[model samples]
Target chain A: MIITPIDSTAPPEPTPTPTRTPTPPASSASVRRSRLGRTLEPFGFIAPTALLMLVLMIVPIVLVIGYSFTDNVILNKNPEFVGIENFVTVLTDGVFATAIGNTLVFTVVSVIAHLLIGLAFAMLLNSPLVSNASRAVFRVIYILPWLFTAAVIAVLWRMLLSPNGVVNYLLSSDLEWLSSPALALGAVTFINIWAGYPFFMVSLLAGLQGIPADLYEAATVDGANGVQRFFNVTLPQLRPIIISMTLLDLIWTSQQFALIWLTTGGGPINVTEMLSTFTYKLAFSRYEFALASTSAVLILLFSMVLAFFYVRHQRARD
Target chain B: MSKEAHGRRRTLRVLGASAAAVALFATAGCSASSDSGSGDGGDVTLEFAQWWEPELPDGAFRELMDEFEAENPGIKVELLSGPYASTKEQLFAGAAAGTMSDVVGLDGAWVSDFANQGAIADLTALMAESDYDDSELASQIQVDGATYMIPVVNFVYPMFTNDDLLAQAGVAAPPADRSEFAAAANAVAGLGDNTSGWILPLSLEAPNGIQNDVMSWVWATGGSMLDGGQPDVTNDEVTSAVEYIKGLWDEGAIAPGAFTMKEQDKVEEFTNGRVGMMIDSLAHINLIRETNPDLKFSISALPAEDGFDGERGIPYASWGIGVAESSEHPAEAWKLVDFLMSEETNAKLSSIANAFPGNTESVPDFVAEDELFATAFEIYQNGYPANEFTGLPVAEQLMRLFDEQFQVLLDGGQSVDEMLQKTQEAWLAEF
Candidate 1:
């Protein structure tokens, strides 16, 4: 749990005063009552949200984790406790291995693309050369892809990358972008970067805006060039936002299902098979609910490890 | 009465009237139930969920439903139709929630899984009572010793050729053997740059496209998708068949987007005069005829490999209606099935569907008169069901594994031998 700025705004830390002595409760019962009241006070405010999280998030996760240990296929009337059979099967399966590799590659490539492209756009938008009206127009244009549903965007891209589609028509090249096994994953990764960069751009732009103008002015006075200022001032200032956005982008990209499913259905082969799509196919298409649940738990573990590593890396950099 | 008292009295009168009206409506519902029981008045609506196109300019199915309602007097049909993919999805959801329709239109490939899951009722008793056991379609819908579906329409997947394209390419006849098919395809490819000699559905967009569409060739070469209820893709016959397809691909006879085109896309391409020939179900014949009336086309069985048995692969797959296991009104549901599978109704509907009727006695005059349909009917009666070997509960997964490996081969990333070995290993692990 990386502490955000909101967490820093909590109640002031207690200070010890040598000159003034504070009186304590006279009775143990009164002290106990005070402690109990204090302990439960925040819970009163959090109870509704806690209950909601328990029901909507925690409950389903628990059920999935439980089901992963059983032979809980949808067609099976009674799911018997099979211990770790499903997990063992999932671990031994080659498709699961392929899915893991695909997911990692997809996440890393997509996050990097989003960061690089987003940073570039943010810089361009923040530049003195761009007019305010132009900045506003470009912002709208850049974020437009995010506004459309994933299904619609996927379909639009599918048509565009189709064998005889607009891409081929315009380029006069007979490239099978979405259908070729070698090219399909790259095509989807490109689409994802296009659709996702806007989020990064928006967040990075905000972070960029929040940096004090004096810092850049000071860097300039110290004989720092534009590149030097960006590296020393801009990047450091935007570290927290970059870290959080990258973490979110990694999770979202790994869990992406609809766009890949709708466009290539995880393949000309399983070339574009992500863990999310594969898990969905296991449960819905194959009715292997237990295996799917196991895969899902594995994904949760992957996300946790990724977040942990990112937080640690950020701490090390600091 | 005083003015305030009079207003209160008026309100009470209105409430009294409303309560009486509600009571009368409740009574009427009871009476309707009673009337259905007595078979004297009122309608017994049976919900029928299917994936067929809802309306086709005075389609035979719609007409038959109207006729059945009029003839039966007390029975009415409520249709729940949607696209096939979503309908199958909803069926699974409905099964889990115990809210499945009284009768469901099921693909033949799904029968085994659904029956094993106990999602559908065993229709053995009903069929015996109705003497439907005599129908050939009955056996196709049976698993082990139990029948679970009333087959309505059976499709035979055969090769269809655009006669004009074949003629333009100076090909005189439909190919009857693999070598000839390849030659003809090359010839057609030579006709124009825009034209493809053959269109192969290599896209695993849907498992059915790969499992049934492309695998039909493997079957034609006397290869089976499964061996003894286990996933087996590395057998010599199947491997050789795939190699032959790869040979076709190598020769540039296959379409440009062979790996992306769905079955429907292939049909669309063929109808648009882009492909000389395509392998698809007989059900698409009517669609092609209606969509491209000027495109002279002919249908034939898939070409068999040399030195193999003369019998080519003609898929005898079907779509049928089944009573839900949880249906309360099994008798009423059976009535609808019986009506739909009756000789006359089945003939009319199956004709429109461009399929062989489940009712063997109901081969329409048109089917018998047309040479192509007659050939398809003969094949439908004699040929093995496309899903006979691999229609197990794990069919989809098995097909997916094959699709993955086959795709590598298609992309020229792996040899046929290596692809087969990898696919076999995956299959063994899964099984």
Candidate 2:
């Protein structure tokens, strides 16, 4: 009994157990997962915008593609699946070829003029000769055409270019601008360039402001004159913005519906029929939705190719 | 400031922002919800889609709606009006979505197309209950032995003459024949560079505009736009008419901008005394009189070719009302259509719209107030209904086919024979 009491009062001897290191906070893999989650946190904030793009943009494109393969007349309740019949019809159609040609001509000519005028104004505004106040005023004035709606601009130009209208009056020439088969497309293209260049002006002006002044100074010190400096320093620096804007302008001008529709409506013998107006006429006028959808898909493909160049440039920059 | 006070301020800001968002959402939700409900308190609501031009005097339609609502206490109506194009677009969009208005106003030419597509309901039974079921105008809306719509109002395309211009040019008013027309046109055209002798709506804005303006010429030559439901654009009559128009173009008798001027632009030109003679619908008489009180003008049947008698063919276009196939309130919709076709309502509407009533017996009294309406009414008797593509499911396409070829010919890009042949071939390929 005395021995049991001694044992009960005494502390137990420590066992020879290997000591475990304090858990190394968390595993490296877990740390990487956490880091990934943190990186994805920003994506979470943009998910709603991404979802909208998917629904609004991507879904419509998919639907259009699906419709392109069907005999989807507006009057028909049920669209029959016709495989590549619609595409075949569209491709074989002569009107589509003419429309493509018009669209190309319109885009090329308008974009070139847009860039030249936009860059000219942008350089002028970016010059040291321009006071801040004067620059602000000129900016607003130059942007005025852009602020106007396409319909209003088209109507205004239609009035101006009319045979008995102010433009002929000013020029003292009885030139029939919009009604002439030779001049209708050119006149509309001119109006488009007028209305659309201001966008490029504003965008290029901002881009010009971002270039380092020292680079231009150095360019001047290297014996480069105004034109030389522009071609070597300014243009090279503005290359990204120019490329991006060119792509955007190409897409917009190719899909220019309102201006052409309001002005010529693919008229004067369809010499001004762009793909956009042609598709619209097909759908709304002819109720040939399947053919219109095929045309629309072709336009989308063309635009996407241009968009691809833009996206590739952007990703490369990143 | 204390941290606690800052926290309190932040909390208040968040709460205010939340309240603002909720209120915004509530307002948006209310507006979205109200789009579906009756404006006035009623058990059932029906949407009546109409192309009531707001810019024009439309008080008669409003009065008709008021009368209808008074008589039908349980049902309320909401008007959906806009330009013809916009209204048609809305109706079509609604039809596709199964949310179309119970009653829709459609161009008469499109009735058969809509009926064939089953976009509109067959009103045969409802029309049978009405006295106008067997009327000539009602017959225009029938397809495949079923009356799909009730014609409401119509317009006849006629020539308007500026009396002062005629006197100034020493040309007689109401050119008796095509020779006189050409002479008057030449005289007026020779007056000044700004003044045109004649104005034709060569613009391809719509088939109705260009076709009505020029097809009457063809018809006057005993030509037809359609030969047994097929386009005969190359027929001798059409070729002769085309040659005449081209001659007018070459002679500089037509307005400088006539090739591209819309119907409205033509009206503007005529009202402003810039044109001596203009081909337009009779509906513009009131508008012209209002715009130019001192501008004396006369309306007459379009002139015939020189050798032909002064007798002419007038093109008439119309609009009608129909029930949507998907209408939930078709019975109530029929009531609106019935009321619209009633003699009293028809008279009132035709007067305000400056149109001839679909119910021939209900011609408005004011129609006799002016020689223009009188002439138009007389011509309406001989009008060919101008439903050139009736029963053609590809009606709009046929119109477009004609429009394109007509545009080419107007632009002086091709010969009449070539253009017509091309159009004929195209029509054949499509049909």
Candidate 3:
């Protein structure tokens, strides 16, 4: 028997022995129908979700946009289109300007603080110096604030920060944390940060664990100090997660209405007024639904800009 | 196609069709469930949406509805109850969608807006059509000469003073005038251990604080926030009241968190003996009594200015009721309204709610039994029930706008003149 070695890259020679009848190609109409079925198949699977989104989200958005151009809709039996009048009114209003400024400060500060605190906690939890049992305990404790709903968080913080509440008793100072024009905005923001940081912490914790040990070891071998290793290796490794979480937090925090509403109610004197509260007051409190719609549309556009960046970042990462 | 590919495609198509059917059925099911009481039946079921059921004593409102159902053989009433805020939101949403309940619990403040939008039926027309006697009704909220709402029960705002605190400060009685109120407030503050003279809740969230507390001062002096149904917030009486309140704020006589405090907080402060006084609703009398049984308190007419000598204006809020314009059974809804407004039912409801009856011919029995109610009744008889915000367009918004400026005034961020001026402008814009 002759042992032959086949060239691996070469095409195999075809061996022919048996004969078979040829199958005829189908008619053009059947082929077209099959192609159409393939195309329509995925849509069928998603039809329910698509229908729900249309009814719940897209329809409301379109209606609100339409309303922004009208005069006192919902309350008016026959609202006439005013075309940008509501937009002008909302833009020129001083309260809307104040709401915009406050929303920006609240969003920017919350996102930055959430990132820093979340990263710090994630790193601490990820540390090998800690026991697994201790980490698990701390993780639950850290995540406790996030477990509460907005209403619960608002009520809890209100009780805790009242003039004669435990916070005051502990500090031995009678500060009106949720009432003072100077303090209310900062107070609500702190509560939001507390309630929100756990999301980032959990996400970054998983990201931290996923980073290979070799990068840190390499940095350590290359004369990198702990801080240097963190800046050079850990932070860079966590950058994508940081960006994604930051954008998400920005979106969530900017739209925070329930906490502010349940707490200071955007007052002493509009000190804590966010765009969400401003729009709500116009529609519900003031019954100026058209004006509210205008404000809402503006907020939607702003959110879409943030969402654009988020989507772009996500795509690039993918 | 291969047999496997053909099978896969068939499976996908079946799954898609099933999903579409499920979605369609879900939507249809929701629509059917939402139209529950509107179904065709031998008996008509009227959906009554209200916050009043929760406010009434447990099973009291339900008993009243049972009585109505018993009296009318072919009619049934279904309650949709919630807190005031949630109820208001639901009613507004329903109104916008033209799906409001057959009968609605309305705030007097909401009548003008609801009527303007044609969301509520014109009671004047309903009354005429049914030949319902409107003479016995105490008052009707009207817009454009058409009645849109009628008060079912009235809750007057009276001055509530913590007797123990007043005694501790050597104050002999509840203040009868603004000057006395100021002096007594200061005295109470001077004897303080974190205790303030008064709790003035001016929260913009629910700025009835302005209507019930701040404006009650002006109203108590027979001053009106309106002149011929127009904004008159910068009038002398309103200015004087604002000045008086500002004086208290400057002297630290008002509660610490007045800007953010709500009606509930005001009641809480008075109940806990943390504050000496508050202008509070009669609706809260039972609540205060229940929350702090040992807290001694007295009710009085909101104090007038030093030298004013006219019949005082007593600020009052009402549990106003209306029929939805979109109600299919408008006649049946009117019957329920008429039943609720009857002399016997009105008296019974007022007694249960600790409020005054809306029927001119009826008096709540509690007025005879409860001393506080007797005092309130005498006060009500002597003074006119005044609330200019009621029946005004965007009344709550007016209160909130005034609240914002008044808050600024209290914080010393603006003068009383500026506050009134700005508030006047805001009010005029709404008008």
Best by lDDT: 3
B8-127: candidate 2 lDDT, tens digit per residue: 755655565555556556545644733563445556778888887473464756777889989998878888888888987897777666677888988765676677677788888766
lDDT values for all models: 0.79, 0.78, 0.90
Q: Give stretches of model 2 more than 4 Å off.
A: A1-47, B1-42, B53-60, B129-139, B205-207, B220-223, B307-312, B381-392, B410-413
Candidate 1 chain B: worst-modelled 10 consecutive residues by lDDT:
B31-40
The model with the greater lDDT, 2 or 3, is: 3
Q: Which stretches of candidate 3 lie over 4 Å from their true place?
A: A1-39, B1-8, B28-41
Off by over 4 Å in 1: A1-52, A169-173, A209-224, A306-318, B1-45, B53-78, B96-99, B129-133, B136-139, B191-194, B218-240, B285-296, B306-313, B351-356, B363-391, B411-431
Model 3 TM-score on a 0 to 1 scale: 0.94
Q: Which ten residues in a row have the lowest lDDT in candidate 3 chain B?
A: B33-42
Q: TM-score of model 2's chain A, to 2 decimals?
A: 0.84
- Could you estimate the TM-score for every candidate? 0.79, 0.86, 0.94
Better of 2 and 3 by DockQ: 3
- TM match of model 1 to true structure: 0.79
For model 2 chain B, where is the 10-residue window of minimal lDDT? Answer: B131-140
Q: Which candidate comes out best when scored by DockQ?
A: 3
- DockQ of every model listed? 0.18, 0.18, 0.49
Candidate 2: Cα lDDT at B69: 88
Which pairs of residues clash in candidate 3, taking residues 3 or more apart in a chain or in different chains?
none
lDDT of 2 by residue, A1-318 (tens): 122345766788787798866657658688687577557555555554555576568888898899899887566778898999998899898989999999999999999999999999999999999999999999999999999998899789878988778999999998878877788888889999999999999999999999999998998889999989988989999998998899888878888888888887777777888899889988887677788899999998999898898789788878
Residues A1-318 of candidate 3 have per-residue lDDT tens digits of 235698999998898767875545757678788789778778777888988888889989999999999999988878999999999999999999999999999999999999999999999999999899999999999999999999999878887998868899999999999889899989989999999999999999999999999998999999999999999999899999999999988898999999888888899899999999999999998889999999999999999999999999999999
Sorting all predicted structures by TM-score, with the top scorer first, yields 3, 2, 1
